[model samples]
Target: MKARASSQSKATLLAQHVRAGKVYRREDLAPYSTSVDRELRQLVDQGALHKLAQGLYYKPKKNVFGEVPPDENELLAAFLKDKNFLSFNPSVYNSLRLGTTQLYNKTVVYNHKRHGEFVLERRRYEFRMKPRFPRPHQVTPEYLLVDMLNNLDDLAEDRGSILAAAQRKLASFDRQKLQKSLEQYGSAATKRLMKRWQTAEQQGSAA
Candidate 1:
């Protein structure tokens, strides 16, 4: 009976630390209980927490409609254990008006750590390890254009047609900014492609 009471006490303490619509790893709640795993299991059984992954949990928040899902940023922060990551859908490329209209179903996270696919709370993510990526606020059309060309082979769009369209519309982008982004983020092939297009544009202008 004393053991049962102790478990309940620890559970209560852990519960106090949990916030609704927040995601947590098992270790984040370890300080509240002597046997955190046991208490976590108990919480899951009691419907106070939902297990999102092997070691991740979420506290559901209910509204008039139904339970609110944990915020994507919060979820990624918990999963990556680092806040220096950028997450976005590949569909954002379509906004560039670069002839890319196909929508991607998976979210892509570019970070210095971790690589490959992971499913978090039923949402799919393709984690790609990169040496560098722009901060959230710094992402611009120039960067997206460079990124699209960098990952051109991976995209479903017709490469020849997209390249042609981009060459035709090259004057629309800020040349200085695009060149800087290209030098920083563009792959070798993308740099070569952009250089060729710029050369052609210059020659056409001279003609």
Candidate 2:
């Protein structure tokens, strides 16, 4: 009876601490109670929270429409335990006017945590552990240009057309920022592509 009462009491306290619509892991709740696992499970059954993955959970935010799905950044932030991640899709290149119409089935996250693919809430996320990200938790234009070239061979687009389009679009980018990004995050192949593109553009202008 005493143990059951303690569990109940702890669950009540935890409910106050956990924010609605916020994702949390076991570690986040450890300081609240010793029987956190059991209390968390009870909270799930009581409709106070929803279990996401094995160790992930969230308190659902409700309204007239119903419970809202977890925010992508918030969900991943809880899972990764770090907010310093860049979330983007290969298809973002399409917005660069590069004529890349290929659809990507997954979103890529560049971070310091887990590498490879994962499925969260039925959505595919590809996490890449990089030595350094272009900018913490952001995908800048210069960074996109560098990354698109770095992973050019992997994209499901016409390689020649994409390259030609990227070369054309490169002229519109901030030259200094592009050069800086290239020096910091670009691969050798990307550097080569940038060099060739710059030379061609210079020659074209001179002609």
C-alpha RMSD between model 1 and the true structure: 1.5
lDDT of each: 0.90, 0.86
Query: Which residue pairs show collisions in model 2?
Result: none
* Candidate 1 collision pairs: none
Per-prediction TM-score to the true structure, in the order listed: 0.94, 0.85
User: lDDT by residue for model 1 over 1-207, one digit each (tens)?
Assistant: 998998978887898999998899999998877889999988998899999988999999999999988999999888888889999898999998878899999999998888999998789999999998999998999999999888888899999988888888889999888988998999999999888888888898899
Model 2 poorest ten-residue lDDT run = 131-140
In the range 1-207, model 2's lDDT, one tens digit per residue, is: 998888888899988889988898988888988788889988998999888887999899988999988899999998898888888888988777787788899999989988988887778999999888855445678888888889988888888998887776777998998898999899998898788888988999999
Worst window of 10 by summed lDDT in candidate 1: 161-170
Residue 28 miss distance in model 2 (angstroms): 1.7
lDDT of 2: 0.86
